[model samples]
Every structure is written in structure tokens, then in C-alpha cells.
Target: MRLLLATAAAAALFAAPALAQDPGHDMPMPAQPQPTSDMAGMSGMRSMMSAALGDYAINREASGTSWQPDASPHAGLHLMQGPWMVMVHATIDGVYDWQQGPRGGDKAFVSGMLMAMAKREVGDRGTVQLRAMLSPEPFMGKSGFPELLQTGETANGVTPLVDRQHPHDLFMELSGAYAYRLARQDSLFVYAGLPGEPAFGPPAFMHRLSIMDSPEAPITHHWLDSTHISMGVVTAGYIHRNWKLEVSRFRGREPDQHRFDIEAPKLDSTAARISWNPSANWALQASWADQKSPEQLEPDENIRRWSASAIYTVPFGHGGYWSTTAAWGRRTSAHGDLDGYALESAVRPNLDWTIFARAERVASDELALPPGAHGPAVTVGKVSVGAVRDFSLTPHWSFGVGGLYAINFVPGALRASYGRSEPQGAMGFVRFKLD
Candidate 1:
């Protein structure tokens, strides 16, 4: 029954304070304040009821730490009363894939989430917010049928296959926002819902289009910053102090429809970002993106891209820390064309271990093949490595484990009928948290 109406809407949103403390109240009753460890203003009341139930409010703060580098025991919950706020998060994972088929079957996974936010506070500096969210559905495991395609076949291709099931990616989002507090470090934040879709770097875990924690498999290429399925995006940003600025615009259609012409004229994307921290350990970031795609039929073919990256962090001794990053990019298309470069590193010998590595090289062109198709249309090099650990076991809770490996050198019938060379893979995960 749709998992019993999503477990009775997550037990009536966590038993709504025991149904508002019922006891046949007649009046007098007000004394309940004491619970602080900073929950970021109750995570903005579940992002204002998930932007009034249209979804997409994905994180406005509710706790921090774990910005990936592999460390997940997961812990987050924020609750507030007055204007209203509520947030909940849960995660369970165990994935092991060594590739082969049945699309590499599966191994283990589980995930859950719930969110709500509502706000009003319209004095002094103004405020208005609304939001909502829910998630569940992800599972995998099935693969056995290749000994050279099961010899001459006689049935019993290792059994397993009764219509094979395991594929899910559920979603929901709603949003609305208005803010003003142009002081105390500055603020302006104007929002328009249908948000969720910000998975930069590492191509969001090498692009599988993220969604795991059992929302029914397909994880990596990072996509659950709370789900923003399509179109409509506008952001104007600034952060003073350590320096930060942003400009954004993302119109619509292109979340894996693989571009089949949605009447064209709606893939206009623009982005700009700048970050700086001149001293104290030094820091810097720069970004730019542009996607036109509207006029086609020849005439220079349209479709362009550009990229750049740089990072450096050093602390050493005592608590230990070290970092490095480098990146470069280019792209053009009528069908395909690309150029790439990358380098990465990480180290942290204390506070619960850490280590990382990366290398990359890419060259492509072959704008939609089929005239003779030989080698060298360009396609080469790739590599990866990973490790992470964190154990806080108390003061609330924590746990984690990680592993990763990837490779691609292209070859074999031009990387087996290339769809952008895909081979060599490895992964592992485990996490739990409560605070």
C-alpha cells in the first residue's frame, strides 16, 4: 500500500510533539525551552515545509562536516517551534560492485529522509519561507550469466532471473523564499522553488546520475542534495568576509532525456562563481559555465563548454592536513568533442584518517561517427583512488568506511563501440549517525 502510505507519513511527522501535548488543556501551559547544540535555526523549519510542498529545499543548514571525501555515518535532525521547522535524515549503505553484468547485480543498501519548513517573521529585516520533502526506494543485486555467454546454453545460466526487479528513484519537492538582512556579513537570498540539482566536481562521482540509499540503486555522479528534477533556477549571491560571489540561471529539460529535442530553445545555462581566502592557509576557487543550444541545422553547430579549477591547503603536524587540486577543460558539439586534464591529492593523518588520489586525461572528437571508424579520434587516460575513516562513537554517535577505484585506457574495438569508454570499476560504503 505504497509502504502503508509512506509509513503513515513518517509517523505523522515524528508524532508531532505527541499530538501537541494533549491532556484536555484549558489554559496555562508554557515552559519548554532547553535544547541547543546549534541546529542552524532549526534548519529553517525543514526549509519551510520543503518550499510549501513543491519540493527542493535541500539543505539550508542543519549540521555540518562530511562534505565528502568519504566519511559517512550520517547524523542530522533539527526541530523548532514558533514559525515552524522540522528536519530528519537517515541512511544505511553497503555496496560492493566489481562489474560484469545483470548490470553488476547488487550487494546492499537502504535510505530514508523527511523534511518540512515554514516561516513568517516579517519585521526588522523581513523573512518568508516554505518547503517539504520525502524519500525512499533503492535496491540492487543480480548478475550471473556469462561463461562466454553461457556456453551452448542448456538453461541454468546460474539461475537468478524471474523477471529481475530492483530499480527505484522516487522524488518530491516544493519551495519559496524571500530574505533581507543585508548586514552582519550581508544577505539577500531571493528564491523560487523546484530546486535540487547541484552536484559539481568529480562529475558527481563519475556520473551515474546519483540516487542511492535505496531510492532504488544508481549511485555516483552525485544527485541527492535533495533532488531538483528539472528547470527553473535563479540565484544571486555574495558572502563578504572570505570573499564569495555567485550568479546562476538554469532554464529547463536535460536531466537525462539525452537531448531528443524538447522543441529546443530551453537549455540556456549560465554560471559564475569566485571564491578567495588570501591568507590563513590560503584558498581560491573560480568557475564559469555556459550552454546555448537553441539554434541548430548547421552554421557552426553550436554547443560549447569551458572549465577550470585549482586548490591548495596545508596545515601539517598536530592535527595534520594537506591538499592539492588542478583541473582544465574544453568541449564542443554537434555530437561530440572534448578535452580534459586533472590532478588531485589529499592527506590527513590524524583526527580519524584520510587519503585520496586522482589523475585524468581526455581527448575526444568524432562527432557522431559511422564513416569508417578507426582508432585515434582521440580518447585516452584515466585513474582514481580513495580512502576515508571517522569514528566518534559517542557525544551523539558516528561511524564510517569507504573504498573506490576506477580506470580507463581505451582500446578493444575502440573501447567496445565507445559511448565514451566505460570499464573498470570498484566501490564500497558503510555509515550511521544520530545527534
Candidate 2:
């Protein structure tokens, strides 16, 4: 108990500063007129906004102009200057997360990502869009973020991180797309990028409205959306009203240890997804992917993955809402098949307080342990609950302090390494976000 308290105190120091704004989707910024001296940049931006948004004055989340029928809200910097409509999302999460059980400890770090996108109508024909995303983890460290039992990718970008959350690359994503509107509610588009995501899983957790309040990566990340950083990806999609069909071909190799450089592109993997937004308050998807060689250490292994998920959000009072997600996924490999499931949710009744919980069961590998500790496939279950107190430092940014405790259920074979039958972990963090 004392340790947890100390951890929380340290987290407070980490939040001394931070982002410009959150993605508040409903907030609208009045367009600034063309420039005069000090406003030159505003003029150019205005011109870009006019060309892209047309009469689409509101911001809606989804890929390109393929609107999510019931997209959740986000508060972001919306630049609607001229011919371009642009959106920028960024945040720096400073964590002092301390986990107790088997693979837990006083692990901490400050990591975040910045993503910017812009679109413009092309010659009265199609909509052209460009996106850039970056994170500074490459030069930061090799161990990446610490999360109990979290495994995938490599820590050094070479050896498997084993039980840690892999750091995102400095260039998380660099991509572009072109879309042609066929009707008021229909469009066809093509998107391509280096270090991009295929049409496989839900938007990566960081971007998901359901789990945005938590700092730790979901243990099921591997089975669900591990391909968020494919070396190369080309996606083609058709959107009709509240539904979208997408297919993609992408390089399957995980990024090598050299975080600063781009990996070789193989275009050896494929995936498809069907997304339905039955209403403006819910989103659903089913997806499948075949990755030829996603991990460097397991070059001979081919992975076939499938997943389905439902996300829902309902606005409440005073800038608050209820958001949740439940997802299931599976991976089939030569070794065997493993299933992963997660259900998480958060509710904020007001701006200052939030409550959240998560429960997950995932397949873990004993082989991921040191060579001598190798065993067979192991299944684990964990449940956690947490809350955060946000100090609204400003209208656009906020600092928060929160803690979570988790209970784990482990199989006997894994007991030797975990040290006990049931281990528990706890984390405390100072979270900062563009609010």
C-alpha cells in the first residue's frame, strides 16, 4: 500500500507539463479570413480548407471522408483555412505504472504520438488525403513501455520484447489516399502508406474511444491490432452510408531493431474488414488477415487472424459520456490456435472524474520465457478496475492522476515463472491529454 502511494506521488511530478488540444469532434472553430501580415499562415490554411471540406463543416471520425455513421466525438485542432481541411491529434502520456504480480514492477515512461491528416478536393474529381504520424520512442529506449504480461514485437526491434509493450517508431505512419464520391452516401477510395495499418482490426487502442483513458496496452493487442505498423499497406474501400467494405495488401514483417529507418516492404499479407455503424452511437466490425511473416524470430510461421468488435458511446452531461468495447479474436498458426477476448469500458459523469474497468482472457506462450523456461501454450485471465481524477489545467489540455489494480489467473505450468498461482499487479500514472 505504501509503495502504491509513493508511486502515485511520483506520477504527479511527471505531469508538470504537456498537448495543445484533444479531439473534441463537436467543437467548431469559426473560419479565419485570408491573411494580412501576421495571418499569412491562416490564409493558406483557409484556402486549403475550402477546397476539401466543401459544405462538410463538421468533423466526423473515420478513414478519409468515409464517415463513421455514428462516430464518437473528439476535440482536435481543425484547420479550415482555404482549400484544405486538416486535423491534428497528439498526446504525451507520462506513466508511473507499477504492477505487482508476476511480471509487474515499478516501471515508468513518457511516450506519446502525433498524427496529422489533410484532405482536398482534386480538380472537382476526387478527394486527395495525406497523413503523417510520429513518435519519439526510437531514440527513447530499447525496453519500451512496461506492462505486465504484455508481449509482441521486439524490445530492441530485434529480440522479442517478451513481456513489454513495444515502442512505436518515430515515423509511425506516412500515407496518402484518394477518394471519389459516387453519391451522397457512397464513395470509393484507395489508401497506401509505409508503416500503416491494414483493414484488419479496430482502430488501434490509442485511437479508440472505449479504452482511451487507460495508459497500458491491452494484453490482447497481439491478436487484435498488432499490425498497426505494417511496413507497407495499400487499402481499397467502398463506403455506403453507415457501412464500409475494405481490403488491403501489406508487408508483414515487423519493424527491425533499427527504429529510425523504414523496413523492407514485402506486400505479402492481406486482410479484409466489414464495418457497420448501425447508428451514430455504435460501430461494429468483423475482419480477417493472413500475415506471411510478421515476426523476425519466427520467419517460418504464417499467421491467420480474425476478429470482431463492437464499440458504443453515449453522451451524458457536461462534456461527459459512456464508452465501451467488447472484442474477440483468434490466431491460427502451425503451433496451434489461440483465442483472445476483451471487454472494457469507461464512464465520466463530469469533467473531473472518470471510472473504468477491463477484463480479458488471452493465450500466452511459455516459449516466450527464457530458453530453459520454455513450456507449452498457456491461457491467462485478468481483471482490473481503475479511476482517474483530471485536473483541467486549461480548456484544451488536462492532467490526470489515476491507479489500477489487476488480478491474474495463471495455469500451473506458468506458475514457476510467475512465482504463484494467482498474481496481482497495480499501476499509477500521471496522464496528460489534449482535452
Candidate 3:
């Protein structure tokens, strides 16, 4: 039923929007009048977006309000109608996964995300933008798919999910923002969302150029980017040249097992982040947050999280680029402190092929214990490699197939439970996307 609803929603979203064109793949589309002004104006529609401040390309914007390397490549369908510029991005993956260990399980599931954005010039120095993001992850089941040593959220209201990646909420983001230019190189902006991301970690893994092609959740998700789906958030920021500083108030509680409904909003959490683009090829950020009871299972716990990340991208031939990301995150509370580290990279040799790899180490207390049990955090690691080959289906669509192999490292103390010190996992997937 959830899948059916998602399918209906998708049809409406895609069929009712303005005409779309392949913005990144060089697919042919009917010619349209191009914009003459640097800003969105009455000139006509174009297959592009612009920055809110300086008259620059819009590829710098990533998930939420985060920034990626300015030189990163974008894969989506874009159009401009009148004064409003619109963009649509979507990805769907059907995956078969297997984990080889006593604690492992296998499953076939579908995971997908859809996002749309519209922005226009409010006046000479102001810009207003609206965005909506949705997902069909509820169809993957409340417990989500198998991921070795991946832990967070709940499968049912009463049990903590361990060794699995829980499904995302049906609604990921519904937000709006307005920016006012303060000078030639400066702007002030405010954003508010009923369900949106705060100024937290790096752009969520699925939005990062380095890791977006892989259909697996990072073990470091909780320590770094789990807050990407907060129930409520409001942020204010200042951007000058290539630097940005922002602060947010948001709801800290993780979403419950019920994946189809919106929960009550609370602004009990606070965070601050600073971002910089040293050049077109490099984007960097550091952030801190004080979250009040971020876990539904641990309502009394308060955690302080810190994260730092750097992303680099270099474009080469037409529709080809190399991207890399290195990130570190730590969370501290009365229970203890845990840290996670990650590095990932991807290279698109050309329009048809992409190669990607990721390595991560995370400290987890959930892996060595059962539900409701307590134990010291154990550090575990994983490394994975994969590749995808895409075939263009139309001017705005592409299909691809890929597979990944991963090795998980377990500590000696927990080897008995897992059956091996090192367990292996693999996944094969097919993807469809608007390119």
C-alpha cells in the first residue's frame, strides 16, 4: 500500500511539472530561449540554476543547506519558466544484499528518493526558494535492509535496531528559504522546515558526489548525518564570498518506527556550522550540536556531537569527474563517547562508467549487545568497492547496474557472536534516475 501511494505520488510529481531536460548527460532536448540576465528573470527558461548571492552556478548547493565543492557535477532535470527556476532530482535502486555471518541476513529491497526545488528572484537583491523531498523507503520495511554492524533507530517501537539500517521517513524535507544580498559578495538568509536538516554533518551520504552512486548506508550514519531528517528546523546564516556561517534550532528526536506520518515538532536541539570553499574544487565544513535525547529508545540521554568534513571534485572530460570526501565525527554523552571516520571516492571515467569505493571505521556499543543490554563501545571497520555502467534511455533518464563487495572487521571479544573476526557482504543493484 505504501509503495502504491509512493508510485502515485511520483507519477503526479513527474507528469505535472514543467518540461524537463537532461542537464548533465548532454542528452538532446528541444531548444528553448536562454536566460539573458545573471539572475532568474523574465528572459525565459534554461536548464540551470544560480546562486542566491553572487551570480554563480547553483551546483554548489547539496543536500539541505550544505555545500559541496563548486566544481562537482550535477545529474538532474532542470528548467526555468518565467521567473521561477525549477530542478528535479531522483534516484531509485533495486538491491539484492547478502551478509555472510551468524548475525547476517539477506534481503531484496527497493530504496528511492525524489526531490524538487523552485526558486525565483524576490526583488533586485532578494531570492526566495522552496523545496520538497520524498522517499519510498517505507516500502523497504520498517526494519530496512541488512547492513552488517550498522545500528540506529528502531524497527518496532520497543526494540532497538541493531545491524540494520532503518527505513527513512516518507517525507524527508519540506522547506523554504529567503536570501537577501547584503553586498556584492555577501548575503543573509533564513530557512525554516517542518521536516528538514539542521546545520550538522557533511551533506548526507546519498547527496555526496563521492558516495552517491553506492546503494548502502554508512556505518557512521548516526555519528555524522543522521540528523538530515529532523522533524523541525529553522536556520539563519551569513554568507560572504566563499565562506558561510549558520546556526539552527531543531527537533532532536529520531523518527519512530512509523514511517508514514509526521510527528509533533520540537525545537529543543541547537547547532552551529561553518563552511568554506577555498576554491572551485574544495569544500570544507565543521559543526557542533547539542541534542536533547536524539534517540527514541534513550529519551533521557543528551548528546553533544562534533563533525568535520572535506570534499574535493575535479571535472575532466565532458560529463566526467573525480570526487573524494574525508570526514570525522564524534558524539559524547554520560554513557560514553564514540567516534567514526570515513573516506570515500568516485571517478566517472566518462558518461557511461563510474567507479566508487568507501572505507569507514565506527565505534559502536550496539553491536556487542542485545536489545536493552549495555556494553562498552567496540570499534569496527568496513571497506567496499563498486562500479556502475549507465545507459541513457531518453533525454532525461538513465538506467544502470552495479555491484559492491564489502569486508567487515569484528573484534575478538565479539567474534563468538558473529562467527568470524571478519565477515563479508555483497550487493547487486539496478538503478533508474533522472539525469
Segments in model 2 whose C-alpha atoms lie over 4 Å from true places: 1-71, 371-374
Question: Tens digits of per-residue lDDT for model 3 on 1-435?
Answer: 233234434543563333433354232332333547655333443224466434445778898889998787655555555665566678999999999887889999988798877777886788887887889889888889888888888899888888788999999988888999888788999988879999999999989999899999999999989999999999999998899999999999989999998888899999999999999899999999999998888899989999999999988776788999999999998878899999999998898999999999988877866753558888899999999999988756789999999999989988988889999999999999875
The candidate scoring highest on TM-score is 3
lDDT digits (tens) for residues 1-435 of candidate 2 = 233223323323332222222333332233433356567655454334332222232333443222322435544544432555555556776776665555656666776776666666676557776777777667557777656667777665346776567777787877777777787667787888887888987777777666767777888988888788788999898877767798999998877767788887779999999887787678888999998987777789899999998888877666677888898999998878889999998888887998888899998663346821335778888888888898977645688888878877778877777778777777777866653
Q: How close is candidate 1 to the true structure, as a TM-score?
A: 0.28
Candidate 1: stretches off by over 4 Å: 1-48, 52-75, 81-398, 402-409, 412-435
The Cα RMSD of model 2 versus the native structure comes to 7.9
Q: How accurate is candidate 1 locally (lDDT)?
A: 0.39
Write out the backbone clash pairs for model 3.
none
Give me the candidate number with maximum lDDT.
3
Predict model 3's lDDT versus the native: 0.83
